[model samples]
Target: MNDSEAVMKLILHGGNARSLAMEAIAHAKRGEIAAARTALSEAAEELHHAHQLQTSLIQAEASGEKTEITMLLIHAQDHLMNAMTVKDLAVEFVDLYERMRASKGVEA
Candidate 1:
């Protein structure tokens, strides 16, 4: 795929991952641990895809095949970074929610 197409895919994957992470947090808040875990897994998958794309670009640049810097590419990177941060926090939130449920004598 072209650079623009790859960048768009990165943005799409990042957005999807972020949404899934948020969904996981919501599920955890509702005490639906299984569903929360499922959502997190899906988010991870999306992140994996995005990361692969990013790595390919990095490798190309490292091999002296420079990719032109563009606003869209920067935006895509921002989305990926934000989604990664959210996913990391979502994992913590899910763990906290499980602990809270356990402390309350509710099955986690």
Candidate 2:
């Protein structure tokens, strides 16, 4: 893909991952462990796709190809980083909710 298209793909996947992660947290808050896990799994898949797209750029650079750093690329990177942070927090939130449910003897 062209640089612009690749960058857009990254942004799309990153946003999707972030959205899924947020959905997971919401599910967890409602004690829907299965649904939460499903959402988290989807988020992980989207994140993986984004990472793979990023790795292609890294590989091109390693091969002595110069890639211009554009504002859109920078924005894509920001989205990826933010998605990662959200996913991390979502995992912790899911775990916390699970523990809270267990403590209160609420069936999942």
Q: What TM-score does candidate 1 get on C-alpha atoms?
A: 0.98
Clashes of 2: 0
Provide the global lDDT of candidate 2 against the true structure.
Answer: 0.96
Runs in model 2 with CA error above 4 Å? none
CA lDDT scores, all candidates in order: 0.97, 0.96
Residue 89 lDDT (model 1): 99
True-vs-predicted CA distance for residue 102, candidate 1, Å: 0.3
TM-score of each: 0.98, 0.98
Candidate 2 per-residue lDDT over residues 37-84, each given as its tens digit: 999999999999999999998898899988899999999999999999
lDDT by residue (6-43, candidate 1, tens digit) is: 89999999999999999999999999999999999999
Could you tell me the C-alpha RMSD of candidate 2 in Å? 0.6
Total clashes in model 1, counting residue pairs 3 or more apart in sequence or in different chains:
0
| Residues forming the 10-long window of minimal summed lDDT in candidate 1 | 1-10
Best by lDDT: 1
